[model samples]
Target: MESNQLPLRDIHLPEAIDWWPPALGWWLLAILIPLSIALMVWLYKRITRQTAIKAARKLLLQIKQDQQCDNSQKLKDLSALIRRVAISATTRNKCAGLTGQQWLEFLDQSVKGAPFTLGIGQLLANAPYQKSPPNEQDINQLTRLCEDWLNAQTKRKK
Candidate 1:
């Protein structure tokens, strides 16, 4: 039959797809990209913190094992160690300037009691100025306190 005579109709096309409401892959991609980036950043921070903590632990062990150094020298080393670790764990502006009571107070934030301010930990403040070395017992106690502070650092949140 002739097309015009047979009453044939012209072909019709479907409407074009809309731009909104993207596909599942695209939505997943949008969500996953940021999540992956956040995870990477968190992992990097965790690794760096762990590295610093490990180094501090090794140094603590060294200070404990050094037999030749007198108690006064050991005290000085311990003080410096704590200060270095504090600066690494926080901003330099936050810890580098702290001293005496203020420094002790900052340390007490982690330990159960206010040891730095009230207990043998106070000896750290006078450590540099003390003409004579602290007694062996006091040195031992202060060493334990420093160790406790180190342990707290590991458990602390970044």
Candidate 2:
């Protein structure tokens, strides 16, 4: 056969890659991106909450250690610290405006039994309005109770 008479093959290119149904890496990234964002948000919230609790605990310890404050002053400071911690760690509506038995009952809910309502913790409510200052023993018990309640509040989940 003569060279001019031979048949020739046409140049053919491979098919173009399909854009749909992305590769595995892209799919993993699509799933991981939202999950990582959600995890970060959750971690941020948890850290802030724990930080608030740690700061509150430090303040409570300082209040307990102060010797200059009299029984009445200590009672007032302890009560204020409890209120501040409760308001910060819990919903304001759940803790604020609670008084007398109601306040004690709210505190009791966090720990075992009704320590606040039935035990020395009750002193918190009456101490503020007493004719004389609370006794040293009662003050000590109340301090311990307040500290325990603070610890319980810290361990609680949202």
Candidate 3:
């Protein structure tokens, strides 16, 4: 038979792949990347918060037990410590500018009974400036209040 006379068929190929429904590996990568990033951020924040709390508590204990400083000096250090902890717990603008009743009120928000405003914590306001230091009992009470505030900050959501 002549070549032109013989029956023949054209070559055929399968359809091209579509990108809309990605492969299983791609779908898993898309889902896992964002989830891992979110988890890392959460873990970083939790670890930093715990570190700040632990350091603050240790410093507070040091201030409480120091033999070199008198109660007034200790009170001042405690006030400064609380300000630093508050700044870490929240933001500089929120914690730094506050003073007097406003500072006390801010500290009290994280704890029960508004202690910073109504209880032994009121000593944080002006006791440092008094000629006589806060009595030992008062100093001890204020330290406890500071510890309570730090613990409360840690328990709160980030």
Candidate 4:
């Protein structure tokens, strides 16, 4: 056959791979990345909240154990401890600036009974102003109440 008449054609290559439609693995990875990030954020929040509660509980224990701080000082410490824990666990708007009966009511909402508003727990508001320290029994009861609150034994309204 004449060279010009040879029935041959030049090699042809396939079209270049399309970049728009990614492979299945890439699509799965795109979907999974955001989910993994969300899960990590949730876990971090949970762990930090748990850690805050644990540290606050330890501080409360120290306050309870201290023999040097008189009842007045102990009450002061306990009040501050409760406020700190509350602020950490919730928004500042929920607990900060609360005083007198309002503060007690806020606390009451969490406990099984309205202890803060109706029981020895009310002393939290007054103990700071009193000239004399509260009795040992009252202090013990109030401390227990604080412990219950920190341990989340109290019902969560949320």
Candidate 5:
């Protein structure tokens, strides 16, 4: 065969295509999926903080109604409810491992100084197993402060 008459072969080049999928990457998806889930959880907790506080309020109301029950128990329950809700609403790292005045300060900081002032914080801190139960007025104040904190948290999220 003459050099000019040599058989021609079709050369196939890689198709021009986008390397990235329209959908995001597995790594991005992995990060994003967890982030989205975390965001959802945070949002859920923010919205429901009020409900938890409300439940606590109801418990307090019941405690008030039950004159026979130990006041200390009621106080302890109230404190536990608030702590649980606080832990749920914010990162455990922020609220956990906090005790005594430090825990009260944590609550104060977490709520951004709404209604939970140093006094309220102190009350909550000193509440555990106290022989003297928190009176109706004290419980009312605590409930109000918790509701305020929940409201403040919700507002911050929005």
Candidate 6:
């Protein structure tokens, strides 16, 4: 057989090509950097929300302890603390402007009824400006209710 007609034909092969561009690293960085930033932001918000709830729990305990005393100031503080935590958990627009029965209802709706029932909500609604301070038992109950509400929120988040 002729050399050209043999089984081993004269086939030409091209040089190896580098199709991968250098900018691939930059493109990957662009996507991963923003993703990392977004993850950090989400983590920060979650941690802050948990911290706010912990602070609220401490404030509720203080209020309960002061129940045997005059507790007018403590009740005011408790009201403010709850409002702050609620706002943090949700948003200012959702919770900030609420007051009176509206505020109570807001709390009840947010917590999913683990703690802030209609009766407790009513009691808390009138709490801040009440002429008579709550007794020790009332304070204890309020504290337990507040803790329950916070726990419910935590569970819901989970």
Compose the digit string of candidate 1's lDDT tens values, residues 23-59.
9999999999999999998888788777887899999
Candidate 4, residue 95: lDDT = 86
The TM-score that candidate 5 achieves is: 0.57
In order of lDDT, best first, we have 1, 3, 2, 4, 6, 5
Model 6 reaches what TM-score against the true structure? 0.73
The per-model lDDT (C-alpha) reads: 0.90, 0.86, 0.87, 0.84, 0.68, 0.72
Summing lDDT over every window of 10 consecutive residues in candidate 6, give the lowest-scoring window.
113-122
lDDT of 5 by residue, 1-158 (tens): 78788988789899887757645676688789999999998778666766765675676567557777665666676677778877766678877778876777666764755345465646677766466777777776776676666556555542
Estimated TM-score per prediction?
0.79, 0.73, 0.81, 0.81, 0.57, 0.73
Write one digit per residue (lDDT tens) for candidate 4, span 17-62: 9998899999999999999999998777666667778898899899
Clashing pairs in 3: none
Q: Considering lDDT, which of the candidate structures 5 and 6 is the better prediction for this target? A: 6
Cα-lDDT of candidate 3: 0.87
Across residues 62-135, which tens digit of lDDT does each residue of candidate 3 receive? 99889899888899899988898887767678879998999999888899889889899989897856777788
**Order of candidates by TM-score, top first?**
4, 3, 1, 2, 6, 5
For each candidate in turn, give its C-alpha RMSD to the true structure in angstroms.
2.9, 3.6, 2.6, 2.6, 5.8, 6.9
lDDT per residue (tens digit) for residues 45-113 in model 6: 899889888888877777766635455565566677778888888867988998777788777875655
Better of 4 and 5 by lDDT: 4
Error of 4 at 94 (Å): 3.1
- Give, for candidate 2, the lowest lDDT window spanning 10 residues: 44-53
